[model samples]
Target: MAHTIQGKKQLLTRVRRIKGQAEGLERALNAETECLAILQQIAAIRGAVNGLMAEVLEGHIRTHLGAHDISETQRDNDMEAVVAALRSYLK
Candidate 1:
């Protein structure tokens, strides 16, 4: 998609950060870290993942829905609303 064309590096950096978070969780598990701390790390990883999902969803709305110039601004506005709702829901 156009996202990869323009946002490849951006997306890759996010994914790599997520990978690091996952590895941190694994290390915590292996090292017998406290359960509470481990859960916090998992929560952080989940947040990062949710953030990535939002970015992809936004891109999809812009790329596909925005393509039909009819109501492009409305679609953009709707996408923003959806993103805000998602953040609230995810939280």
Candidate 2:
């Protein structure tokens, strides 16, 4: 979470852009925009979200699992936690 705190601003910027994209999609639906353009908007939003997830997941792995200061038990727990989260997210 410390890594996330350090990258808070950058992460928020990405989240804001995703929010904007969602709003744009909503507007397109309300306006009855063409199907292709609406689909493109949805795809952009999905890509942005996936990018955000990947960045945060990488940070978590490096900080929690890769840190040498932590004990083996702690690292195992952290690895399991990461795996569980990935399973949930993928589902």
Per-prediction CA RMSD (Å): 4.8, 0.7
Return the lDDT, model 2, position 73. 94
Query: What global local distance difference test value does model 1 have?
Result: 0.85
For TM-score, the strongest prediction is: 2
- Report the C-alpha displacement of residue 38, candidate 2, in angstroms: 1.0
- Model 2: pairs clashing at backbone N, Cα or C within 3 Å: none
Candidate 2, after superposition: displacement of residue 89 in Å?
Answer: 1.4
Per-residue lDDT for 1-91 in model 2, tens only? 9989999999999999999999999999999999999999999999999999999999999888989899999998998999999999889
- TM-score, cand. 2 vs. native: 0.96
TM-score computed on alpha carbons, candidate 1: 0.73
Segments in model 1 whose C-alpha atoms lie over 4 Å from true places = 69-91
